[model samples]
Target: MSTLSDYLNEHLPDGWQKPQLVEALSGTLDRATVYRYLAGSHPRSPAESVLEAFAKVLPGVTVVELRAAANLSAGAEEPWVPPVEANRLSHAQRRALESFIKATVGPIDDGDEPNHRQPSVDLQPAAPALTEQERAEVESYVQRLYASGRKDLADRVASSLVNNPSIEPATRPADA
Candidate 1:
């Protein structure tokens, strides 16, 4: 069985029963569909929405982990840098980094945001709680960014989390 199937089969009974989970979804999915998913009768991976809803109420599991298990996620290939921090870097620093990247990665797309990016106040709100796994991933990636001398990107990704506790998504790793 797939890891997602095994996780569902094992954990479903621990916290939520079949009928109970169907109802808990608030009709997001039909009873028969849940049963089929539970029974491992479905061929495709569960929809992101289904897994997301399950992760919402499930205690320990995370949507990121679930998506990985379902073979939906490609796994982290490169560091997931933050864009909002571009504004914080001095123009010289931005140019230096861009030159380094351009030499290494050919050319950045024309649509890429330049040094002057949108402010944090302009960012859209994200409220769902970040799972432990997601938090760990963010911390690990941020550390990698710092170690690689990309403090600007690191600061951008993590500064929002530590600098402001009130920003909903910044408080957590962001909605899984």
Candidate 2:
């Protein structure tokens, strides 16, 4: 089984350092979290989130590698990138995806600055809320689904609640 530690050790070679890794790593990860993934001292196998973050910055690392490391790929074929045409991203969609990636993951140092031409975005603050009664009702629905041996249904409800764009993930109720 390939360990996350092995992946880190292999990738961080060629004079790579922790500070460089931290700066290069995308997502909301902190320095302490990076330290927790150190390969030199007390390395921890990265969680799915850590692996996903690594995928954004590290070349040749992707969802395939993530699954492989977890032994979930089940003898998968060699990794490959889909052709641009295969992706079917329209010109507008491509630009929008580039903009979103730059905003979230920053630049990839591919020898040039990003085009920086994108459609304007209307930033809006969403304050989604569910009344106590509504929360209780949802919770009851989930529990009933689980009790009836329909955990998949309960998980779907919980996933929808957690993934709703209107609600901030941090503000979700504990039961959700």
Candidate 3:
């Protein structure tokens, strides 16, 4: 596999040097940084913005190719598999999602008097309780979370469902 340094040396256009390249990169990176990149000794992965700049400056060399040369990806084509039924969010996730929605969408009010708003006159109906199948799906998601090394999140999710009086506990799979 070609390293980033090798790619740079091979592809840099004629008459271009480290200083010129640095200047072309809009001074975000210094000449020494360019040297380190050419030396293959930069401490961190090149930022995407830097890669984009390089793509603009270097003719015939693309960011994707540069990323591949940097060992960022295998550059293989793969079939996409839709995710296992979308994972059900825990109560905490639900709260976070609701907060995010509210932050982005702001409060919704039907054109009624703001000061006279009534709690009984909600425009949208309340969400229905989860069905048994949905509960099973949530349990599956929790199990997957634990398996994927997110035990803390999984524990919180399970605990939330267990502690909630409104939600019935999910039935566990026999194999679990």
Candidate 4:
């Protein structure tokens, strides 16, 4: 169970240091960022762009392998599926589930009473719709992927945007 850092150190090119690797990445990432990732101290998962850049500079490394090394699932290509239990939930059942979850986890704001006030469970709000400009930005990024000869990736991105209607693009204002 070697960690990603171990793999990177073992396969580093002769005479290459962290600074050299940063330079090889064309400064898209900094030495400290690279070190943090290698040290597994990053607060969040490394962005796909960062992983792709590392794959480009590191010999015999692929983005898939890098993702796996970071403990990410390799089956991102699989179709999305809702849980069977989720698909069968009625409105009452859903409410019951939400109540159960809230009861188990307690409330987000417990500082007010500490033990006196009952835990409050609020329903999460719907996600905001993407503005026209944001839609254009995503389209532009997908186009760039196509231009870079990564049509498969471009298609996947496009498909994800289309399939997830909660993030549908908003209609522009008439005056604007």
Candidate 1 vs candidate 4: the TM-score winner is 4
For residue 55, give model 4's deviation from the true position in Å. Answer: 0.3
Over 4 Å off, model 4: 75-176
User: After aligning candidate 1 to the native by TM-score, how far in Å is the CA of 1 from where it should be?
Assistant: 4.6
Residue 168 lDDT, candidate 1, scale 0-100 = 33
Q: What TM-scores do the predictions have?
A: 0.40, 0.34, 0.42, 0.41
Clashing pairs in 2: none
Preferred candidate (TM-score higher): 1 or 2: 1
RMSD of 3: 19.5
Among all windows of ten consecutive residues in candidate 3, which has the lowest summed lDDT?
113-122
Q: Tell me how far the alpha carbon of residue 168 in candidate 1 is from the true structure, in angstroms, after superposition.
A: 46
Off by over 4 Å in 3: 74-176
Runs with alpha carbons beyond 4 Å of true place in candidate 1: 13-15, 74-176
For candidate 3, write residues 45-138 as lDDT tens digits: 4665666667788888777666555544312223334355435666654444344223322223222322122222122312223444455556
The local distance difference test score of model 2 is 0.47
Over 1-176, each residue of candidate 2 has an lDDT whose tens digit, in order, gives 12444555566636777788888763467777766655423222235566567667667656445434432321223434657663775554444334422233221122332212221122121223344444444555555556667677567655544524454322223444
Per-residue lDDT over 70-110 for candidate 1, one digit per residue giving the tens place of the 0 to 100 score: 54432232345758966786555555454433233221122
Task: Write the candidate numbers in order of decreasing TM-score.
Answer: 3, 4, 1, 2
* Global lDDT of each candidate: 0.53, 0.47, 0.54, 0.53
Alpha-carbon lDDT of model 1 = 0.53
